[model samples]
Target: MTRKVDYLFLRKGSQNWHLKLQYPGDLGQKIGRKRIEKSLGTPDRAQAEILALPYIQEHKMHLLHGHKDFRIVWKHRFEPGRQHVGPAGERIIATDRELIYLDPQGVITKRAPNGDHFIPVPPLLEQKAAVRREQLRRRGVRNSDDSIIDTYLKHANVTGYNEREARAVWSLYKELTNGKPLREATREDGRKIVQYFEDNGLKSATIQKKVGWLNAAINLAIGETKLSFNPFSAIVPKRTDSERRLPLSEADMKLVRAGMEQLDRRDQLLLRFLATTGARLSEAFEIESELMERGCRYVIIGRKTPQSHRRVPLPAAVLPFLPRQIDGQQFQGTARSASKRLNRFLDDIGITDPRKVIHSLRHRAQDRLRAAGCPIDYRWALLGHEEKTVAEGYGLGFPVPALKRWIDKIGF
Candidate 1:
């Protein structure tokens, strides 16, 4: 068990919540107090819970990052919507119902005295919200869980995580928080979260991922609400040794192709595409069919990294059958859903190595590209990987025809 920081506490004398903060190092008292105590002001546990979150977050920021201003954290806890600096200098947005944040004249808007926007509240939107609220009520999803989950979900698209997956992480936190707001999440609450994972016999890596997701949510919430303290950051998850995912060999590739001979067309196409292009399953789905059909010149593989996602040349054989464009994402279901079936096929093919899943096909593609005399420069381009060194950064990578030749050699 790790030694804890008790940042938020319920006073035994007053029964009201109080903030107790101390920076880790014995640094300047000017940055923050040596020991600070402030009344959180509500006898009600629920209200106290909401009030404590940002102060706790602020204290942690001060302790770890030398954040000097505690007043900002104080405001965030009590007021979600307040005047603050914007790109255009000063701007104010209400707690909710804020988007298209400027009028034609480009002036900021203010919320009600309670920090909530009341006007322009559409009845249809209200009705939908009421229905959802009732649904949550019936389902027993606590109030404290909803906004925290929403915060994470809203940021998921920007952060490149599935909203459903991020919600699942906070759902666990919400269960732990009950109906209390995420603001009230104390050091003990964090300990309980870690304990829940450990008690359930989860692996350290799994627990770390879960906790990491929560920390991200907290950070996003803090950034928007202007709170700095994050108890989740304080909880260091234990690291575990993990298996290395080595690529499949040429012989192994032959076995995989042979195994795929019996798979469904969708699965077959998906695997073959991954193997040939050396694209991630994600980018494999998003290949621009129009670019692919244009003389098989280049297929757009949407990668997170800009340079890696450049137009990759398509193998000739796939051009005839490939669609011109996928509407949005390439796959309908999640990668996990596809992987469950893909993994089964991988196992059937005698590639029982856990690390060698559909992803390893790309590695095999790299291997085949190398075996076919493709230069390292062309290989990295096809694989959607960044150049390893500054020396390799001389020019734009190999042309389409050169990349095509190497990828062509490995075609099914």
Candidate 2:
């Protein structure tokens, strides 16, 4: 027959008590006693009763045989190879029906009953998962410089530059490609490219124009491509204000005029027309006979713009160099070859300043106009620039006389 057992508790000290599972031992010894106490310093019998139930349940088999107590059996359940040791020698335990073992150093190492080592769950897994999800959301995004530049080229064409100018702009874009992604291109790369042009003897204006093209490429990348920012936006080109003007002095003018006398009559008139009219070399080269009205003292020709197509007055100094009848024909030779011949004339005259070339005549005209007190408005009109206010809106058309007056004041 199976023997029934019950737990007995006795107050030992202030709050501690000895709890024994009562059962018959082999002839005499009663079941072993285990300590039961509350951490609170109170002799509360209710606390012992609550703890005694589980203790008895766990050691019920051993308790009935009178071979062990609740604590001893419980401790044995936690030890890897010793499920029969008494509580004092069992350095392991079980709770929540799961085994928990402590190393000799008293550090609790596990909570599983299978004796498997435990690891604290990492707290950052959720955060890492969120980041991974975001990365996936942005994958397959396009960000190539070529794609950006192609979009810009399409828009630039609609905005009015010819194929040649557009091609020049693209050449600048190619030079800026360091084979890195747009996001990785930095301001330092822009600075280095700017410095390279400067070191290679390029003029500041040329460098600025080249840099402007590069900046346009970067802007296109930002506005039309996937790039969110332009690395070259903040980079400023170095300025060399000293090269702004290269006007001919009176002595230099005399030498240049004398050299003109050595050329053919038509060529002499061409040089005189350029000096007196302050026309660009290309504009002057493209002039037609029909554009010139006899006795009108002004020539009207098509230029880069309608505003640029204005009457350019003939100065008295230009009369001696004019032909009896103007002929409408293209220059027989290239502008470059003609420029070389003109430079040779300057060399012969001993004007050593390289900047004192044919373009100097235009600068001299501006200088002369300023010296004669031509108003800024009149000068701008003579130069065929769009009026300041009009440029802000449309553009103003200055009367031919107003432009002619400014040119007349710049007498040879």
Error of 2 at 240 (Å): 4.0
- Largest lDDT belongs to which candidate? 1
CA lDDT of every candidate:
0.65, 0.59
Question: In candidate 2, residue 388 scores what lDDT?
Answer: 34
Candidate 1 Cα errors over 4 Å, as ranges: 1-145, 155-161, 191-210, 234-240, 292-294, 303-308, 320-332, 371-373, 386-398, 409-412
Please write out the lDDT profile of model 1 over residues 1-412, one tens digit for every residue. 6333366576777877687766554554557457668898877656766787877765655554442211122223123455444467544443533422444366645433323311233478766876666544454564644665566656665344455555555666666756446666676777677888889877667677777777887788788884566768868555665555778876777888678777887777777677777778777656535343324467666555565656577676565555665445445465666778887888998988878887887777777777888777677767766644654445656666766777787665
lDDT of 1 at 319: 58
Question: What root-mean-square deviation over C-alphas does model 2 reach?
Answer: 30.0
**Pairs of colliding residues, candidate 2:** none
Candidate 1 collision pairs: 53-183, 57-228, 57-229, 57-230, 58-229
Q: What would the TM-scores of all predictions be?
A: 0.55, 0.50
Model 2 per-residue lDDT tens digits across residues 326-387 = 57653546455667766677787877787788778778877888898988767766666653
Q: Which ten residues in a row have the lowest lDDT in candidate 1?
A: 69-78
